[model samples]
Target: MLSTNPFALSDTRAPLYFSDKVALVTGGASGIGMATAELLAREGARVVIADRCRDDGEELAARLRHEYGQALFVETDVGCASSVQALVGRTLLEYGRIDCAINNAGLSETPVDLIDASGEQWERLMAVNLRGVWLSMQHQIRAMLDAGRGAIVNVSSRTGLVGKPRLAIYTASKHGVLGLTRSAAIDYAPHGIRINAVCPGLIHTPFVEQKFGDGLPELARTMNPLGRIGRPEEVAECIAWLCSDAASFVVGVSLPVDGGAVA
Candidate 1:
């Protein structure tokens, strides 16, 4: 049974670990991003949701506000520098500081052989999956630097660490994300900013469903050693922990939330 009181389950270590903080979540209208934003709000963070999907983003912000006090939505295109800068600007303007940030906006495609992949495909994937994370991080780090302390969790993927059969472009993009995360972590850790990446396995999100379709069940059973699809909330839990003070000493690590598949 779930607790009726939202604060009751925020965390045992700190019932309100994020109380009086500001969190920015890109791609926050759905899936793992949505879960992270809601979790942050439950823990008392003033949440700012950024996504190109204006309707869903605004709806989520409204719901969070009704339940948790402060939440706002900003439509953003992570691939665009100006858009990301505006997102960070809006966050700071509305909430004063960014104590935590999650770069979750991403794009993937139907798997295609490396030999047949087109330059256009590569560009699209790089724009959202790689460049997007970089751009979001660039602006986010600036805000965190001014605030003097913060945590950032970039949503990498299982493809980040290993090659997928026909997902060459996506794999490459995710790998780039991990690279950005590590180097940035090193650059900013001394300044009290912790940067890390989460590599999620076959999570049962709308994306996974759309990609797998009728084969999802069988794919879930074989994709990971756990023989099941992971939940967005599972990844959200890991992300939340990384953003919290409990992970204070942690930095520059790529934690796999892959149901032992990577092992």
Candidate 2:
């Protein structure tokens, strides 16, 4: 059986590679985004948690500040361009520059056959899953361009690589994210900025718990070779690595953190 406490903070004592750097995480109120924010802050990055869940976001930020040294929460709707723009603006105003970013905000679709998929569902998924990444990248790239260097990690999913029976809209949105990551990486590589993606399998996040409930663990066991669901911190580690100088040579790669599920 896989370790039960996969989210344990044992690894938080790693070297402070992110000292003096500033990092931003969208959808950071909970789950993989929250894990990433905490990990980055632990590694010495001034973190900004941006999400629409005001209560949760603010609470997470406060906890981060109490544990780490610096953290801020900005209420944001990644689906709205203005909200995203303001998020970036506020981060810049406070930190002066964005050294790293994890565009983790996204929405998933309820299982429904493509034939029965509503246009509204498609639009909603695209707005947050695809367009949010695009919008976040636009402002993030501009900031990196000004600073002359940066790193970005867009959180895609294993679904982005393979299609599910009733998840066409989600699959499409995630695929779009990979396209955006690759295209943006190429465009910004020469300018000293790197972009990449992480395709997580079934992670045990609050979102996953809400969507799948008690069935999630059994489903996870059958889906991945490791025979268990992944933890948010597991994926968060990948995001932090991609954002660090250690991954300076890594760019435009869609890393699968799926416990051999994609293998």
Task: Compose the digit string of candidate 1's lDDT tens values, residues 69-144.
Answer: 8999999999999999999998888888899999999997777889999999999999999999999999999988
What TM-score would each prediction reach against the true structure?
Answer: 0.94, 0.94
For residue 174, model 2's alpha carbon misses the true position, in angstroms, by 0.3
Clashing pairs in 1: none
Worst 10 residues of 2 by lDDT: 1-10
Candidate 2, residues 1-263: lDDT per residue as tens digits? 43343223455344357887999999999999999999888877899999999999999999989988899999999989999999999999999999999999999889999999999999999999999999999999999999999999999999999888889999999999999999999999999999999999999887788889878868987988899989998999989889988788998999999999989
**CA lDDT, every model vs. true structure:** 0.91, 0.92
